[model samples]
Target: MTDHHDRPHHDLIEHPRPRFAPWLVEPMLRNKGTYLKVALAAAMINIFGLITSLFTMTVYDRVVPNNAFSSLIALSIGLAIVVVFDFVLRVLRAYFTDLAGADIDHDIGGRVFRRLVAIRLDQKKGSTGALTGMMRELETLRDFFASATMTALVDVPFIVITLIFIAILGGAVVWVPLAAIPIVVGAGWLTRPALDRLSARAMSEGLTKQSVLVETVGALEMVKTSGASRLLGQRWTRANQQHSDSSTRQRLVSTIATTVAASANTLAYAGTVVVGVFLIADHQLTTGALVACSILSGRAVQPLATIAALLSRLSATRTAYKQIDAMMETGSEEPRGTALKPARFDGRIELRGVAFRYPGAAEKTFDGLDLVIPAGQRVALLGKVGSGKSTIARLILGLYQPQEGLVMIDGTDIRQYDPHAMRSLIGTALQESVLLSGSVRENITLGRPGVDDAEMLRVAELTGTHGFMGRIANGYDLVLADRGEGLSGGQRQSISLSRALAGRPQLLVFDEPTSAMDQTTEMQLIDRLQTELQGRTFVLITHRPALVRLVDRIIVVEAGKIVQDGPRDAVLQSLQRPRTAA
Candidate 1:
């Protein structure tokens, strides 16, 4: 094969970009009718909010001074009715708001999870902990929608209505609350830059803290064995300190803004009263109208004060939206509308001048490499660690794409095949086995819908898992913990092997499959595999001499090049020959 040390060149695949809309906006738009209901309720609520002042004015100016007892009773009853109506409307607004929030949560939460599952492995950024933190931000977004933030936002526009009422009732004194509006808003605005910085720092430190915690818990055994507790503890302490400090500073800034807004509210009420005193002295305004002015002024600034206090949460929610949006926009592994029709693969593998390197690696694992394994052929890749043995298996499975050339199966490029359908017909066992939480039968079947117990038992027997299943009281019903935590290494490997074999696959790729087994177990597994793999294409990657029996041909790779290839026994003889000094 001609080696090309230069990087492989291929035209970039241009995917048609889908028109993007803000995720939060899109969901709300879909639920517009529900939001419209909330808005109408809020409008009615604000109109009803005027009832108290109006009732106070009527009682003080008309009923009390005129000694109209029947009039007072009638006004009281009317006021009581208005109060009930206001209460009902508020409740309805909250209900509709929460209903809309629920709909959004369902849609966005499902989309986030689906994106996480479908996103291309190479497109994924950040550590698992960071990703987890980003996923948690969805809760922040949902809470912002469901909390008082929405109410405050909706109520803000009604400040104009309140102002109009104040102008009509209190005349020139309307400017008192109107003047305070900007002061309250500015208080929140002035501290925003610092608040934003603190918010971002707090979020960053929070993710760091989450990362440390998750890392420590996931590797608790390793930390204990390796005496890494002190190091991890120090990291945890530092992250906690940073997070706490950022949070404290953030709250302090937020408190300052809230205090200013509250003071503005109080001053607006006091200012209104002070101005009304002059008008009262001149007999230009009545006591009842002055009292009504004070009440309306407070109402006017209440939403402003609320919005000021909620600035911190809004900032946090904004930060969260950006993070989630970035994650959602990542390229999916299976691109939409681009997947080829499913094709039956005959397991004839070929790598034509293939060149590949890992995402961030400095050196290429394979450069201009050529290899072929005909249909129904059994082959073993024998190489030292880091000699491109496992990389070959990954390429054949299309887990990673080559930077140049093609990896073909049955004279067709593997890239052109639908990944799901292609993988379903192949049995793969890696060097490290990972088992999910489930019973042995479920793990073996792996949620493949049509796999019955007969098929399950057949694979279990082939992988020698049937022996252990019989020993356990529950047989195939034995429940395994996450990552099979409670199981022995050999047992975990057995379960993994059984899963790979469950579908009676046409192609088998076993990488160090017997590494965890004892010599007797390995021998039995090899015997069973040899018989089971009849007429099937098999590729075995291993350093163990015993596994050579499973393949009729062997290829040895070194430093990204094939150094030896021949009949299995001949390759073994060549390897056994002693190296001579120059």
Candidate 2:
């Protein structure tokens, strides 16, 4: 609730260090306990994994050469017990890994969603497709944590254990695996630059393709009406091709790295066998020891090979993590302020010496503009298409803050009030009606707690939405398509109006609310709205002259400056007056 602007001049001059590093680490810290448990389980699993080579050595050296059947039986039973216990540990390790991955998914997903919702409207413009793709990247990270790649990473340290065991069984032959370790790791390292570049390009191309498809789907009506389907399809095809090419390149590089690592391990095993044969001939080592040394060499190099195979996925996951981290750090909206909450209040709006501009515009949208509306009065804002009328409404709604000046509601600065509480007192319906896929009753109630059936039906009747509800088979229970696709424009607008009115807000703002309606429907809706909005303050932003008559006063804005403000009749007469000479 602290006003950032109220900080001292010296404080404002000081630049704070970036907080992104800590923000990135916060989620990992939250799941530290689960990660620790997974690590412990992995260590145990790796320790038990050595049993295979140990059992082979014992059978060949102790049982086979001695013709000891009883010893063989005992060894088989003991090894069987070890194998069963190892299997259980592996299962537990996988379970814990999955548990940790799920926790991270839930935690990170919720955090990102909350931040996305709270971001300023201006900041979110035109990035819908990219944002959607970023959300999907979270799934990529979740899968990475749960995949065999993660298991290999955990087992990487156990490579040392395998090498040490080999050295103990056969001296100096272990040097072959020791020599191959650098080759295995170096192959992966050498391919990293290519993998990073290709993976990054592929991710960019994939997001572009996704964005095109999302845009096409969202504006299908426009594409159909304007005959742009072919153009859009061709554009998507190009994007898809680029994405596919990048993916192919990335896969090729990853495959080469994996092959190199695997080949190195194979060569190391061959070297160990040749050396062990010489040692056996010289009476320096046993045949069982040679077998154990080969097995241990493979184990020593397997982790590096696994890592090489997973390089592409790891690179993609790294890119996603960095992108999400930057978004949360810089793109998220500031926290809301703490302010008093009131049940209801008179709707008095004031804008004092306001100066504003859109995010990327060169010119100001408004400069030194001032306006005042008394409580419980209806007013209309008349302006041309791009004259900043809608911008004013957004400011009043607290969706955007003025670059300079103050916007007050009921004598208190809007910034000083709890934004949610302030918005709850106002109702709005825009030109484009937004409706989610749900039943008719659900759309009307909008999850408001105390809105009973009667209240919902009452608002429906008030907005004339009930007229179409009865035509549908399920009445209030009738399901709607995504974004109200099945309904006519007027029907959609009516439902949106019903939703706005259901709240009975003290202040009602409509921005060309009836733009989609036919003339007759528009007039009927205006008449009904007039009665429903009685005793409440209303602000209508519209170009229609007919709609202006419903308001008590009219304010004309030209070039972001108010040209005229007076009673409804006076303003109308002035606008109607014919000019003889310029």
What's the count of clashing pairs in each model shown?
0, 0
Number of the top lDDT candidate: 1
The local distance difference test score of each candidate is: 0.85, 0.81
- For model 2, residues 1-582, the per-residue Cα lDDT tens digits are 223222211111112235435544666677677677777777777776677787788888988999989988887898888878878877887887788778778888888887777677555523456667777888988888767755787789999888889999999899999998898788788888888777667777776777778879988999999999999899799989999999999898888888889899899899999999999999999988999899889888888889888887887777777666655654433435557676786999999999998776778899999999999899999978898889889899888888999998999888777766777778888778999998888888878876788889888888889887878777989888889897898899898888888868889889988888789878887787777777888989998777876799999988899999999999888887765333
Displacement of residue 394 (Cα, Å) in model 1 is: 2.2
| Model 2 pairs whose backbones collide | none
lDDT of 1 by residue, 251-311 (tens): 9999999999999999999999999999999998888999998999999999999998899
**What C-alpha lDDT does candidate 1 achieve relative to the native structure?**
0.85
Model 2 regions lying over 4 Å from their true place: 1-24, 334-345, 579-582
Q: Give the TM-score of candidate 1.
A: 0.91
